[model samples]
Target: MGMITWNCTEVEEFILLGLTRRPGMQIVLFVIFLISYVISLKGNVLIIFISRISPRLHTPMYFFLSNLSFLDIWYTSSIVPKMLINLLSFKKSISFHGCFTQLFIHLCLGGSECYLLLAMAYDRYVAICSPLHYTTIMHSSLCIKMASGCWIGGLINSLIHTLFALRLSFCGPNVINHFFCEVPSVLELSCTDASLNKTIIFFCAMLVVMGPFFLIIITYGYIINSILKINTSVGRKKAFSTCASHITVVTLFYGTIIFMYMRPGDIHVANQDKMATLFYSVVTPMLNPLIYTLRNKEVKGVLLEITRKRHVP
Candidate 1:
């Protein structure tokens, strides 16, 4: 066991061995990451614009969609900008507090995203399965409440876990394997008995991560069942189409997540960890607006009409 010490004077910053050390790959990584950042920003902002323009889309569903887009924008923006700079620059060090702040906000947004996905699934299920009460159950105030819950719950959860992680002592091996400061990566640096940290983190995960995931699955299960029961072919198609985009986004986000951090870090390939982290953190957030907003007819219609009207006068 690495000897534990709490000498704040001992450490000021930590080195991060990012995605790759190969200087040859720097330019290639910069180009690809730059494109991703651009697309992500455009896609999410477009969603927000469309949601605001379309009167017909001012319902609970679109309200949540708008929030989701906002979250995606900030979520990716939190990591990708700094990471892109690190990829191009020789300096790849992060201040100890900055690292903790990044981890805190990252986990908070990630947790909220998980719940937002589930909330969306629930919205779909109610619209399809219990159409009569859809309005009552998903009222404007209720929608706001649910969205608030996602953000507030995520903030509290992030605070709890990050506090525990922060208390642990870091020793000699100050370099993190991944690009950013994740819970597990930071815990690995601790020079103390990490079992307590691990246990607390595990509990936090059950409540914050795994719990929402299971709820999403249950909601989708009902959604699928309700779709299958529709009598006419067109009815089923309509029901499925309403959800296809959200479902696709959910699968992409959650699939990568479960595959990445659900299991113990030991069995997985160490080098691939950064790649998996990239998928959920960068790739998924960038693609979310595309999957949920761009292909959505209402969103697209609103966007087109807004742009045309702006030039009309």
Candidate 2:
């Protein structure tokens, strides 16, 4: 059972006016998005495959990277493909339940990515701060538990947010201005006082977003300090190189996320929102495999050897 009414009793479906309002913009969006989707899937899937097949990558860092790639695949799978279809269709409509389902799955996957990054940061911290203990701290069993915990934790957190939305009294005007069933978008359609929902969202943001950000800041602050104490130039350079790629990825992922959600809802532009969705959805997934793997010589060597053998044979 559910409860959420605005002014009217029913709203069967919603029109998704994705991205741009211009009639001619659909074609451009389609071509660009199609390429992005293919690249995104290929990039993320290749990482998981490489991690599985390459014995050298059976370490704690790669294990988390594999899980991150898997999460990317699941996350992008939730939103981008359906969005591609909607670009061409004249009736860009989705049922209420369909919207909520999309909402749930998207949050489940996206939130998981947030936690995965945090885990990866911790991994980097261990590797750098306590080199002697890194192996012992991040064993296979612990790795599995950490990854599983991330998925479960993200789902529970997303569930709490989504249920709040489900309980709202959506009486009428079911048209969500944005491309997806974002919490703010759904809340806007409700007739009843959504102060509770707003409060919950704020609290969730503090826990999910601010919490991670603070922890990451502290981790990196220590990392920078540790790097400075190294006497040899080569040691400092080596230390900086090891963490540089991870830091870049973290910055890009969190920067866009902060920009998109941490704002007054009144200022939102649907097209900009769609583009913001693209950052974490399409771009970040493609980036993780390319950026992280490319930075690591071992993965690149393995990739080259595999490619060369495939071409030769």
lDDT of 1 by residue, 1-313 (tens): 5643333425567778888899889778878999999999998898787788778998888899898999989888888888888888898988888889999999899889888888888899899999999999998888889999999988988887787776677755788888888777777777776777667666777777788889988888998999999999999998898899988988888887777667764455657777878898999878888787656787767777777998997
For model 2, the stretches where C-alpha displacement exceeds 4 angstroms are 1-9, 264-271
TM-scores for candidates 1 onward, in order: 0.93, 0.93
Q: Name the 10 consecutive residues with the lowest summed lDDT in model 1.
A: 1-10
Candidate 2 versus the native: TM-score?
A: 0.93
TM-score of 1: 0.93
Q: Candidate 1, overall lDDT?
A: 0.83
